[model samples]
Target chain A: MIAAAEPIEPAPSAGAPIDEAEALRRLRQNEDQSAQYYAAWWLGRMRSRNPEAITLLCQALGQRQPRQAEAGVEHNAVARNAARALGKLGQAEAIPHLLQALDDPDDGLREAAARSLGELRAMEAVPVLCTRLASGPDVAGAPQTASSRLQEPCEAMLEALGEIGLAEPRLLAVIESFVAHERPLIRSAACRALLQLTDDSHWGQQLLALLEHPQLQVRRAALMDLGAAGWRPALEPIRRTLAENSLKLMALRGLVENPAGPHATRLDEETTALLAVMDELL
Target chain B: MLSPNPMAAEPTELIRALRQADSPMGLLLATRQLAEACHPGAAPSLVEVLGFNNPGAAVAAVDGLIALGEQAVEPLLANLDDHNYGARAWAVRALAGIGDVRGLELLESALACDIGPSVRRAAARGLGQLRLDALPRSEQTRLRQRCLDALLAGGGDGEWVVRYAVAVGLEQLLLGMDRAEPGHRSGLKALQELAGEPGDDTPVVRLRAGLALSRLAGGAGG
Candidate 1:
């Protein structure tokens, strides 16, 4: 499905990369939450497919230890990071555990699980994502504090659905509802879902129009969504947008690199136009 | 209650050029003109063109029939070619697009097992958007339930497109409902299950279903 949401990598691995044995060793030593978190991030960032590494992360996903509670919100960074690691590991075995994490009480873990599910392109996660979205405050008349629902995984879930593509009309109906959302980011995400569902230029144009939004978050969201959509038609519009040039270049690279794969440096017409645009950005 | 094989007789001389046309361009030209004629005489020749083995001409003929609306339904039903799968599929598309109540049975069975995913998809969508406003409110309610039942059953279709179409049809059917009515909840519940059907692997279907859910969730009735 148009290459699962451009695997957003975790922040550059803490210090240098570690050997698999060392990474596994750090992940197992749960006495220090910081070490375990970095190790989890490292395992995923390094794309470690080792069975033991996967098993450790799957186990970590269930251990919501070292809860970082603030303002009545509880989060286990290690478990959240572990969920992210498992998604990058690319194993069918992690799917069941990820689905379980989806129901975890920790909002952070659920968001992480949703992101990973999209990265893994787990089709089974669609219903779980739908259920989560359906039950969220975004539902009409649901008791809502913008801040509380903002922390929810609606964006990740929407991105996951977009990566998964249209499976059911009911699921699609849910996505369509976000178009009229009071928040711009959610609306941007809905447009991304539509692009993946239909690959139509109309959605690309919808995202492009978001560039005019007064909010930077909404504009940035549109830029990123446009990149994830890989809408070649948006290349020129991205250039014309008032955002920072670096952001424009990054979005362009995402569109060009994604379709042809990272190793594709061929000098085709599309690439030549991209090079020209890149030159202008520079 | 319609003539058997409406195309069996000589196609009226009105479309003599269409009958004589052998080249693709010639056929297309003839068909395009006849499709735009808006004359009752054009209906019979258009029905006859369904079997002509030219897709472009057949598309034009279908458009002509759809333009003729209810007047063309009987002729379309009568001219159904049991031997021509292509023609039959096209007929289903025409009937679906026409939204004639007379095509209801055909639409139901087609959605159930039309062999062609495209045909089933068309039937599923057609069933959802079928015009029932002219019927008495009680009749509309009964027929809507029937339409909902068919859509829910079609949701399990093995082909993702058909399943996706079923989701779309369900959305259309639900949106048209009077929320205060007794059946709206059942329809909404059906849509909720569709969005998250266990073991459903097709994301496109799920995506459409989620959109349907979101749209409903926003409304007072939802």
Candidate 2:
């Protein structure tokens, strides 16, 4: 059996500050702490959006902590934080390291990587994110089991991809695939992303199909996406969902955002029906 | 039937690379499903997860254990003191699912002292679940008082889910009281007021209140 990871050893003690030259020398020497702190400081600088900062951060990311996987310097928080900060910097240069960190045994480290990939809008990270979608939480080998620490960052990447926009064919396929993702969060994330990218494309049909998703919450997400995308074709599903008494009011609200068309008359009917039950809330 | 080593052919992959899973996330996904499949045998895994610092994993483990029934009692009780409020609260709910008398007194004690309103409500609920079977009639009075205290303490929760759980738990305890007794007469009235209050109108709360009211009606009519 390929057992799960052994406990990681702590990194070396905090040391005196080193100059960029000294840090570069230490990194080459395989001293974990020197490289780790240098990397963290570099990534932090990168997030500042200054040209000099971006250069420094990119340099840190390019350098490898070869000892990271070898000497088991896995508990190197500074090194891990640096990797995360690089991801957040959103530079295309950071993609490889960020992708590498996604496999981190540490949940926080993996998420930081995920977020960085998302923030940078690293389109190359899409394949990795897509793989994460399929991993589900079940696989022991996957970092989905790492910790709660990664959940938000993983979700963040999906959300970012949605807001970043995608082109046709591939965009529709990604949306269609994610609609079937086992995790509700991922499915919803994919739906939201698809909605953001919808235009003359056939995304309206995909969103309509998602309305029948097994998870009612996913259906709600699809409804919201359609409403936001102005996919007028979705009015029927949205209206149908709003009419169901057991469904949440938020879903109903999402469907009736426009309050016009078939929606105009249906909204009144649904409101009248819900009013009797939601009177106090209204 | 699924094989025990579902992902045997696939090597474990890195978390970051899970996106391009060599076996298509097969190994990672197999492990999660395997946890659920471990079912009757997964008790130990779930118990061990209670100590995990990761709230997500702990929550998953607890949910698995709760699904396993009475066998999860000892380990869950040990986790009642978990550092995370969510873990402790989930533990309390799992204990309620067990609904054993051994946990009744512990839950009652928890109501008076637990820091988080969610945990307090969960403990109160554990007591409520045990109401018909374990609680001695003499202890019922104190249970009523402690539950009401929790309702008052948990009144202003930012997460309406917690307040709703507390409200429903309060109502359950109230309904269980000996309404025929003059001292218990006002308990039902308090529950009725709390049930209709706008604060408890969330779908989750409304569902709980609906269930609680149904129980109360059954008690009154029976």
Candidate 3:
């Protein structure tokens, strides 16, 4: 027994285990700004399933630190990183924090929050996101940064609502209201959101009608949405649009999105001709 | 004066205003609004504005055209020969993003022979976007092999930026390949060699190579 003196158990290492708590601490309060960024990135990269990581990320989402200039662009790295981490984590618990972050002063942070909300598919955020889509920044006293002036947050909000895909009547109504918004970009975003909201043939038909919209942008958006939604009824219309040389590429894309092989019998002479042309061009 | 809050206007009303814009400045401003609107119907207007002298308006127009997807491809192709380098640059970029085979020929040519680094860079990225996965397996292998060869050749490009683009293109090609396919091994071998080479290769190229290698080894399809 003495000869085989028990191999001494390895001494408990003095180095603190690099665990979630430590990562969270570094992400939250690390003096080295780069370390903070790295920590936030690492948490998402590792796909840490820990609840505390979610909580820390949510808390960090609201934090507005001194603006850092990155590649000549001013932004809050911490909030941006935190919002991105939360989106990657896809934790439901982080939704409220992300929703709150939609109103953050920094446009980048707001965009990041809106994007994260979409990632979580937080249907509850639809109303708030719609409001953000309909209105620019809500804070009266906040300084208008370049991003706010550019209305980037509005784009982010619209995209978020689309990604949520609640398709609730209220949400659809809100999005529909924006379809008529003056900004073609916003209108385009609205079309995308509507397509996301419903697979209804009726909705598809409605989008088809927009193919004749006077603005090329509107027609373009309709073609894109119809294709994305795979609205089979629109195939004929898209084929008709494809007859126009300028619009042919888009219409062909729509037709391709809903291939006619399954419904070959339904193809009219014109559609068949257009399909042949599409085969050549595509 | 253009209304300060264009967001409040209806889509139809906004289109009317964009059409009615009298001066280049006014058209530029309205075009900026339409670009932000993200509607494909704006493609024609945006494409027209792509020829505008104002850098900001041209930039916005380029973005809108790119956003319009295939709708912008033909129009952008029509403008590919525009005298303005900026217009050509933006048109190439939009066409490249659309990734149609129509754009593929020009992009491949540009990546292989363009005098301008920016054009080469855009072409490289455009090559990566060409949905090889959608093609038949034989076509996929053939096209990917061609692309991989082009990218490897581009790795020796004079500009680090172009080399970086090559790395990105290689990653895209590797991603679209079926792991079980024999073609994948060659693509993997190229990326691994690039990753292993530290001399002269920029950090970005090396990083992308390492990532592509890891993705391939991990059996994660791009």
Candidate 4:
């Protein structure tokens, strides 16, 4: 897999430079939220592999002190930053601590933990993540806002499962249950997880069948899965959907994925049209 | 043969709910799911939702389109002429963020001509994100030079935001070029000049320019 681009690091000023020791010191002792936040950010930006840096970050990850919330959202700034830093550090040693953080009361911390665990590919955390998925929203402590649904832990859990790339039978069963979920997001996530777990061309056939599903979300999910799997069976169905303007972008993607496979000779007209677009665009 | 497979019908049921969704919130929710799925098919709908009045939904749509990668590029190009300028601007942004060479000319033209600050800003950033490495060495050098020239020419752009973008684009191009070569110094020199321009350049532009200059000086780019 292609590594994601590294973030641009801010340049250090000409004044007295703060070394890793100082950054660790500030992260450990700083009372100010903003100062500690910057410290955590810099540690990750520097991609510090130091054992001490990892320890300090883990400590920060477990810190529960309340800090200034960013405008509308309330979250543990230190823990969130630490989780992010740990992921960038790409240290497997940080996995256990991140797994512990998955149970953090703050949803944001839990979300960050789940993401880092995925980045680390901590397969051991899969069972716990599945449990979290089975459990519904932690409504009592969750942010009581309309947007909470969008920020739920369930989304992160699904994403982590996909990233881990484990397709255990129990996990597959759980994911399968959600494929027809009433919520489009969950259903879509379920489809993504299924693709990650199953290699059977049967699932690809099922996804192709879903191209005719009434819900736009399901159709979109099927298209996405087909593209990821490079399912050639989807080529014709994807081509047909391009007639619907709303589905064109996704259909084009499906075509891109299926291009010049065994079905190439059969898709002359479609391929010609697609190549025309590419030629025009390129 | 008599009993229908409940497993097979689940997708159809989900699709029904999505189509029947009544509220803006419902539509937004569905859009978010499709985006999260990274479904290329969601690109058109996501692009359509860019014209929606809801800021949250629009932002989600823009992000979703970007996350779809190269799949979203052609559709975004098609939407460049969207009747709604807001949607058109966002299409420009999604294409820019994807940084596919297919949209390079569109972005270049937008930076050179678009009246909206946001559109021009996105275009400038897009130019920086171009995958010059995919081209042959000669083409890479030629394209990098063209990008540098365009950014330098736009340094005097009236909008502070555009200038800030140009500084960033210059930094990106210079960093992407092979620093061992002698021509790389010219790009670095341009960045230094921008950083030193105290009066006309805003603090942010100057800050970016100075950062780029420092990075190049450190031999960070090879």
Judging by DockQ against the true structure, name the best candidate: 4
Identify the leading candidate in terms of lDDT. Answer: 1
User: Which 10-residue window of candidate 3 chain A scores lowest in summed lDDT?
Assistant: A1-10
How well is each residue in B1-222 modelled by candidate 4, as lDDT tens digits? 011122332233333444576876786677666566566666667777777644346656777887777888888888665455556666777787777888877877778877665567667777777886677888777766766666767677766556766767777777787877545776666677767845334444554566556556674321
Please identify model 4 stretches exceeding 4 Å from their true place: A1-26, A67-73, A134-152, A200-282, B1-222
What DockQ, on C-alphas, does every prediction get? 0.01, 0.02, 0.03, 0.04
How does residue A120 of candidate 3 score in lDDT?
82
Model 1 alpha-carbon drift over 4 Å, by segment? A1-17, A66-74, A135-137, A140-148, A259-267, B1-222
Give me the runs in candidate 2 sitting further than 4 Å from their true place: A1-282, B1-44, B51-71, B101-121, B131-135, B181-186, B195-222
lDDT of 4 by residue, A1-282 (tens): 111111123333311456788778788885766567667877886788789999999989877766545542236877898998998898999998998998777878888888788878889889888886654433321444766443446656775787688888888876676666555555555665576566565655666666666655566556655554455556667655412222333334445434323453222345444423321111
Residue A76's C-alpha lDDT in candidate 3?
A: 73
Instruction: Give fnat of each prediction, in order.
Output: 0.00, 0.00, 0.00, 0.00
For candidate 1, give the docking quality class from DockQ: incorrect
Residue-wise lDDT of candidate 1 within B1-222, one digit each (tens)? 122233344335548888888886688679877777655567778888877766557767777887877778888888877776556666777787678889989889988977656567668878887888899999998888888888888988867657767777887888888887677887777667766756246443554566667667774212
Interface RMSD, in order shown: 19.9, 14.9, 22.7, 17.0
Better-scoring candidate (DockQ), 2 or 4: 4
> Local distance difference test, per candidate?
0.72, 0.51, 0.62, 0.64
Instruction: Decide which is better by lDDT, 1 or 4.
Output: 1
Query: For residues A5-31, what per-residue lDDT tens digits would candidate 2 score against the true structure?
Result: 111222345445445455445444445
Instruction: Give the DockQ of candidate 3.
Output: 0.03
